[model samples]
Target: MTAQIENTGPLTTEAGAPVADNQNSETAGSGGPVLVQDQLLLEKLAHFNRERIPERVVHARGAGAYGTFTVTADVTKYTRAKFLSEIGKETEVFLRFSTVAGNLGAADAVRDPRGFAVKFYTEEGNYDLVGNNTPVFFIKDAIKFPDFIHTQKRDPYTGSQEADNVWDFWSLSPESTHQVTWLFGDRGIPASYRHMDGFGSHTFQWNNEAGEVFWVKYHFKTDQGIKCLTQDEADVLAGKDPDSHQRDLRESIERGDYPSWTVGVQIMPAAEAANYRFNPFDLTKVWPHADYPVIEIGKLELNRNPQNIFAEVEQSIFSPHHFVPGIGPSPDKMLQGRLFAYGDAHRYRVGINADQLPVNRPHATEARSHGRDGFMYDGRHGGAKNYEPNSFGGPNETGRALWQPVPVAGTTGDIPAPSHAEDNDFVQAGNLYRLMTEEEKGRLIDNLAGFIAKVSRDDIVKRAIENFRQADEDYGRRLEAAVKALRG
Candidate 1:
């Protein structure tokens, strides 16, 4: 008798255990219907049913692409970040564009803040620049964040966003006036994500090998040029084709006409930040180009579309905390809050092993750590020591690899930053008002009043006009007139 050879493919199973039956399920008989007690069948169905996790709380509607970031100019003097060290070294990157204040099912063309986040797979590690198109944000402190977001989201009672509720909050919180103006202006509704600029809204820190630190703000200017839709046009598009932006991105990549952007940074010396005219750490303000000019650093291009939207895009995680060797966080309160909140949210939504997912996995270097399996961790570290300080050879700590230490000079307590003369939020916002041309100012007032008039309370509208009045007398007067006209 010939020796029977059993065929065995790579040993695999539902969870990598070897399976005995390939086709048949546990049953009463060979010809009988499958039994509920079939462990394999139950495992398969259970896994499939719970495959998807909760979507993002915000920026839920988004798309992603793979690309390369090439250093176009020398920026090594300011940052020791390896990706920007070489003049022409190309670093692999994954970029995602999203709309804030919209649910996963919401329209893409809505008047919302477009999230322009990028994850660079650098040799050091994955560095995430989680940002938005605009340079400024709505609120400065993390305390007001939930309230601010509530205004943008749907009404808790009606399940629909009410302009009255939105304007009510904005009027009460005058600090939001700056970002609110940007939201209703010509660039409010971007024609598509490709045609808008992306900014590292919060100032970040860059440290060189010399241990010299500089505050930096990133500006990714789209090569496609800035394009925006009129309010009427955006409204029609939102109703006509809600998925217009998402479709445009997918179609453009499929045709091989990749979108590109020039990455630039406005660098400020650390010593100068304390004496700058405006509060540099404030998230609701912008550092003017006249004081600190933007210097080009590199170029970002998106050429590859994701094969699986769910696994590649939906599960793809990005956080401001994911910094490489040289880049570090600033004193910006919003950025500090996000450094904790984002990673925490990802852990809750995607699990601790989310970094192992194909989309979020580091491509430039091996993710060597003592971290073992949590929920879905599948022995990524094979035969490797799972503890540090082991006599056996393992990853060792490098003290010199640490980033530049920022000077902290206040009593260590649960109190806020000491309020300086520049603590008032209205100054820079007023400066932005005065900078606008006559026509631009007119449009600004009209837009502000148009949105504010929707608030049912005249007293609240008056309060909002007073806040604008504090910025510029003429600005407040014009807005007041417009609101009155809106009421009439």
Candidate 2:
């Protein structure tokens, strides 16, 4: 049946009083100066002036959509998360795709890692799978995160990203080799948000109903098939249309060509983590697919574009720490750091009451917390018990709130140490280099040389080459030759 439009009586003010003269302001006489009593004119100007919030420190440029995640395979044996309990169970989701290092106005086609963050508004709670396009990060420790981001951003002196600053940090940090290789490869410049893969880069713990724990990594393989722009195509697009990715996503959804991903997870038995070939919790590394094959779990489809970009996308926040009952954090230092940093950044960027916002609020369940008044709070828990541990019975703690006990053996200290088997930073990087096909290896060499040639410091170039040399002699030689040619 075709639905007819029902007309609302008239436009009204925030107080629900009918606005008689919305177009004109009150005045002492006709054509006279506007009067101070014009509340409509005053309110419009005031609200317009305060409309913008501070742009995100990173992942500032993004596009978002409303979607549904349906479980295709039962994952209850691995995770007790209610959303994954039964096949065909659907959970509402919001996904925001972004370019990591870019500002709000930066081009979408730049050679950079993309942010792939998803919020699952489940019956239990909001579960945020905050991740990136790549499976590994540039650093394993959260302590280096700020420094690494600084290198990716503008140089303090020039107000522009400097090649020297970027390579200097990466060269000194051998652990960055794996991610650097990925960043300079074909996948770095994704053709659009629809075609690239998404990953929960950090290994996460999934507790089953049986009280057993398994480590898992999430992978969202794009059903559109992997597509990327070469350096030339990306350069041209950057100049032609900076908002290409955003427009592509919006228009595709509007035309009913919805994009989807096949959700899969690589699960490792908790006991095997101790004896794994590489540190299972290392953020800079990946658990080889051969060792732990990804089990198909679900499908995520984006069918609706957001109505308000600022309210739904810009204000949306995702934190790795926001986990439900079955999901928990691993010992990855980067993930641990993010558990605090992401939430703190959101509080500063979007205000403390961000969760109460419509875009962030859980749809299937009402949030019950003793969190009282804060800026922009919706006052949902009015006149309720403000403090916990009270006899008044506010929100009681659940038995599931307790995290599964993880064995701890390392001494608490700030010293930099490699504590796991095959933890040497260069081994995995070398293995990745060897895994690339001949054509890919050639492109990787050219990409590294192209950027390294712009770095003015010879010592930094030499140091970077040394790291590559340790990875593979042929890889180092080809890069060195290419850099020398470009330099000459």
Candidate 3:
């Protein structure tokens, strides 16, 4: 426990000086302007002015909670991460659920991908599983990420989200087919955060104790089961109760109806990835269950809420690079970009001392670093040696990396990923569409048409339809007919 300072008196200034009166500011005379030397008054005003920070560029609207992850199976054979070493092992966790394309004050029920990021404060360190509710993403390459997000955001000229901007981008980036299909489907708007599934979405790596490696994907099946809101329902709920999802999540935990998920993973041998018919590391696709079934590993449950939302939840940060021994990054382009992008965003958004915060700090172990002060740095290292390989007994590295060396062969150049036989982007999206029921298919077409019909140019609408048609003839035909019906 941290040392607590005993309070013996009443109101005091931030510097611990006793305050004479909080109600009125010091003045030269009655009706005279207040003196500029009132330190308490200055402190209050200064602090109030600095209350807000820059909100996240994406996933701005969010809700989070404290939870426990209990290993229900032995995953040591697959990975050396201590948290998953044995059955019944428990680790503390914090999970943040969010909407992708919205501001901090946006409605919680909007039709957008939900961020399903989790921070596991394990014994080795904090391992963050930063993911989303959907299994696939819009684009495969990080180079297109900013452009893709720009389309989803407000238009530069119109000052509002335009169907023209959105369709123009999606139509040009054919790789977005799979995710667009998933987005405008029946599960587009989740009924509540608890009633949906979560996925790592990107391929990751798992190295066993014997030096054997595997490609891995994660799935968190909600124990609460799948439930969703229709387009009509979401439209009404977004206006009537913008905080509907956040409120439900908070109240559910408070009333003892704690939400939980069954954690699982699909593992593929490293050797198989090269010949897997499709790029397993592609962020816009998925490994079929017929090839690699999901193996149940553990249970994740949220049982506690933060006392201070700003201190704990708002300041909480995550990055895919936060991994323990045996778990490491994959060659997924999006994941590679995220490893750097996430930490940099947090450094600027929170502070260089963001990790020092109680919410983001490792729970089971103290993080020792030779780093010195920056903005609001606590100076925890004291007068210790800053440089490595020093004569002084500084906190030196173990001379071993937490992650294994990744083999590199081909000369790096500006080229697309090495293609596999079934590498076309439309396949998985077509498969997803075919898997839907008749009613679900009708709704999907209607959803697509509703927005597609709003586009001003016929070329943009045709290009968008052509991408879906490449995925499936019937899907494209139905969508085209729906758009015509809506437009005419």
Candidate 4:
């Protein structure tokens, strides 16, 4: 019987048993119904039914590529992260570009902030720098985040994105004015993912070997240069080629036209954060170049196209709190809130063992965790102690913290942030408006008016214009007139 064993060829069941036929299901009789005893058929059907996982809440639509980040300048004075410790050191990176407010099936050319998330596989561990294309956000605090996303998402009753909901929310939240102005400008609808810049929008803390802390912001200036599509051009493209951005990124990489970004950082001394004219940690604001100039640090190049989109891109996860030895979170309220929220979302959406997935697992080092037995948990570390502090040589903490301690004081209640001089939301937005060329300003006003005019209520439109009016007299006046003309 052993010598005459069958089912040893290329075509076999999942259990390595040979399959005589994969063309059709087994039947009780020659022409009778299919049998439940056909385990192969059952397995195939069951696996196909459960092939998909839950989509992300916010950045649902995205494209991703694998790449390399090579340090060009020594930043050891500012940080001790191993990947950036020495010049010419190269780190494997995975970058995912996404649309902010769209579902998995939504058009890619819509006017939305692109999610630029990078996962660095460093020797210490996996470090995730999750950010957006824009340097500023709509709200400074994370408590208001859900409400802001609700306005952008589909309305419950109407089942569509209502202009009334959008205008109403913006009118009430004055903090949204800066990001709103950015969203309506020419750069909002990028021509392709490769053309626009990426930013670590929130301030972060970088501690050097001597434990000197520096607050920092990150930038990725595309070597391809900035290119954007006008509203009319975007409208046609969104309708005609919904996957244009995704297709462009994949095709560019495949054709050997790799995309690259010149990485830079704006470093501010930790002590100077408090006395700055405006709140430095505010998520809705930015430090002017005149205050802290950007220092070029590295080069990021995306060269490889993902072979399996679902495995490499869709299953990948990132969180802002995934820092290395030198980098840590800042006092930005939004950043603090995200430290919990992003990890929680991934734990629920992906399994707790999502880290074990190939795309998310650390490359150079093993992820030693006591956590065991969750959905999809690969039975690694067999027979090893599940708990730390075992006498049998289990992995233990290194006694050093991954990041330096930040000092804190005062009451811990819901007290608002400390008020700073010139901290109002309108100043930077107004400055941005004034900096635009005459033609660019006209396009921005037109874009704002085109959307605002769709509001059902006159009061909503009036309130919307009032926010921009506070930013700049000319901006508000021009936008109000443009909205009026569009409505008529």
RMSD of each: 5.6, 2.5, 2.4, 4.1
Candidate 2's residue-wise lDDT over 260-331, tens digit each?
Answer: 999999999899998898889988888889999999999999999888789999999998888998899998
- Could you give candidate 3's per-residue lDDT for residues 362-396 as a string of tens digits? 99888977777899888788888888878998777
lDDT of each: 0.85, 0.91, 0.92, 0.93
Clashing pairs in 4: 7-18
**lDDT value, residue 372 of candidate 1:** 93
* Number of the candidate with higher lDDT, 1 or 2: 2
lDDT of 2 at 99: 92
lDDT of 4 by residue, 340-376 (tens): 9999988998889998899999997999888999898
Model 1 is weakest, by summed lDDT over 10 consecutive residues, at 416-425
Q: How many collisions between residues are there in candidate 1?
A: 0
Q: Pick out the ten consecutive residues of candidate 4 with the lowest summed lDDT.
A: 1-10
Which residue pairs in model 3 clash with each other? Answer: none
Ranking by lDDT: 4, 3, 2, 1
Q: How big is the positional error of residue 314 in model 2, measured in Å on the Cα after superposition?
A: 0.4
TM-score of each: 0.90, 0.94, 0.97, 0.96
**Which stretches of model 2 miss by more than 4 angstroms?**
1-9, 12-39
